[model samples]
Target: EGEWKVMLFTCSYSVGGVHGHLVDYMQPEAVSTLLGMTYGEYDKRYKSYFGDVIRKTFFDDVGFVHMEQTWTPAITEIFREKYGRNPALYYPALFYDIGPETGAARIAFYDIRSELMAEGYVRQVSEWSEARRMRSMGHPPENYSPNSVVAHGDILKYYRHVDIPLLDAILCFRRGLNGFKQVCSAADLGDKPVVGAELCGAYPEEMDSAMLYRTTLEAMARGVNFVVSHGMWYDTDPQTVRIPPLIAPENPLLGPALKGYSTSTGRSCMLLQGGRRIADIAVLWPINAIQAESYMFRDAESGLPIANWHPNDVVNYALSGMLTNDLHRDFTYIHPENLTDGKVSVEGDRLRLNNAENLQEYSVLVIPGGGYISAGALARIGEFYDNGGKVIALASLPS
Candidate 1:
């Protein structure tokens, strides 16, 4: 028997998938079923529904086994039943000799926001009993979360461009800015040109490894922590699930090139991750404005509601980017709700970011746009101004 370390670095089961068999995870029926089994008021017994479903899906459809089976020595009841005694072997212990084992849960930009509000989207037929109760109570209401809406054009954009950034503004960004030493960026978000940021790309058979290294380095002066080779093909000859351009042992130059790049970038990330970020500016995330725009508009061409970020892309993307990379001054995105919740505090001419142990004191609060700002947010801003903290409002003041 042997043991090995395993870490799931890339898992996107949260949003499902775009193409390939993984897309089955995104299907409405399957998603609805999974959502209900996990979050819906089915019973305490169904508490493990979400994990069990993931296990069943990956194991039954794909040849790959679940993480628990791979990492742990625990035997399942089925295995115990099949054999008279406890099964002596466990894979990957059964497969290869692994020395020390470690497991870390990794995620892309997605937070637990979607799961937190799962009940809002219970399938109508599935909720027939609940629907009856609502009807008896006078009127049933639709889910308020924007994810429930059907938009014309690409649905993936709704998640990629909108939900991710919104969560960043409201929750994740604060934690990231305050405490995280090294920020892990994925292909989509990491693609932004930042001084010490990483970039992800795939397909080595088609692309030269040298070019990949050079281009990535050229994008950022300090280079990247690591270039995530989007994927590696497991079996070259059998090619059963080949999604080329294959880049692993199969691609001659890729492995060595990446190794070299990693070696070159090693100390850079170490140094970058050590320092406390300095910021004199705080940007008030205009989430309310974006939400209002989403509710008010439908695209003339696609008949879909405009992409959630499209309405305020200027403030969210361009301005933020200008401050982040172009200006080279560190800034934090302030969620409006955080103001009402006392997460943001004012002290004489400075606004203090309170979510972290090392409170980030900022000299100026920059409020982007003048759309549907909440009264609480306005009051907080007013208090900041009253306390002599400088405030900058773009376009117009909140009405």
Candidate 2:
């Protein structure tokens, strides 16, 4: 029973802030209010709001031990009260210390896996189906590919030195194994198919380039099944230095539908059609990109990183999606050194795409986000557009 090889998602989640976003939000009045309530009163209100099963999931099964202390329980209670059961997302929160059990082949988190390693925990990560990636290249690919029990060097390092239960008021080390554990906790309970996480330092520049490549390969060795990019940006948020969403209502017809579609199945179908990508293999392929930094027009210091780790941007992804959607090519690539590697070649104003190995057969060629571009690159782009090629640009504007 594995339904898919990998499951793609955003990683800024946790149970009550246990994983990526666990910050305590306790207040005196919050608990005082909870204690003041009577069980009879609470039960009546609970069912009156949230239907039956959810009422059981929270108050019965879990006892909601500290529902008031954790924001989710309280928030979940509200959702159940009004909407009956919470959306599908409510139960499978990674923070629950209980991973998703939808049974659609399982995927696990690299951040959580790393913590297990540090704490002398082990698992057969390969059994899971989803791709496993870490935020940054913490180690080398050759190191973990076969899923050995060597326990990463950092694990040994921390075992010998570093302290546990330390708090990093700031993101002390976005990629340092210590850094990940400070915020996240394991939820898979030792069951998963393919393993992957939002690997790579928050920004590609955090660790030098060479180190980045090694870390990715290492994730493979550690039994990480795939690497969905940390993210692509919607826009930029300078205060947070995060790659924010490029979230503008960019002509619903031209970009993502401003509104979601009706029916979950219908919504999924529409999302696939709107130039967005829905990958199948769920494998790991690292591309270099700032997680998310959007500075439509700003200076470097003032520049914001679109928050999600989008090593490959929309234009290229859209293009890739077009190829995947339209063509049926069994793929193979000569390991691109970078997103804009020699795949699309340009020599003295002559724009040519060599290594058409997989792409040569496709009718449309879409190249989206790459790093900074030069006048020469624009010229080559113009040439490609002129050659009767269908191209879609996400953040890349015309010359």
Among all candidates shown, the one with the greatest TM-score: 1
TM-score for each model = 0.48, 0.21
Candidate 2's C-alpha runs over 4 A off are 1-342, 346-353, 356-362, 367-372, 395-399
Q: CA lDDT, every prediction?
A: 0.38, 0.27
Estimate the overall C-alpha local distance difference test score of candidate 1.
0.38
Residue 383 lDDT in candidate 1:
87
TM-score result, candidate 1? 0.48
Per-residue alpha-carbon lDDT of candidate 1 for residues 1-399, written as tens digits (9 for 90 to 100) = 599666332223423322233322323465567546653564345435433442111001111111111111122333455444333332222223333310000000011111111222222222432332321000011111121211211111222211111111111112122111111121122122222222233233455676555544433332233333334445665254354444455566565676766676565545544223456787775545543332212322334332322343325445555565567665665666667877677778888766333356789988867455768788888988998889987765655
- Superposed by TM-score, candidate 1 places the C-alpha of residue 143 at a distance from the truth, in angstroms, of 22
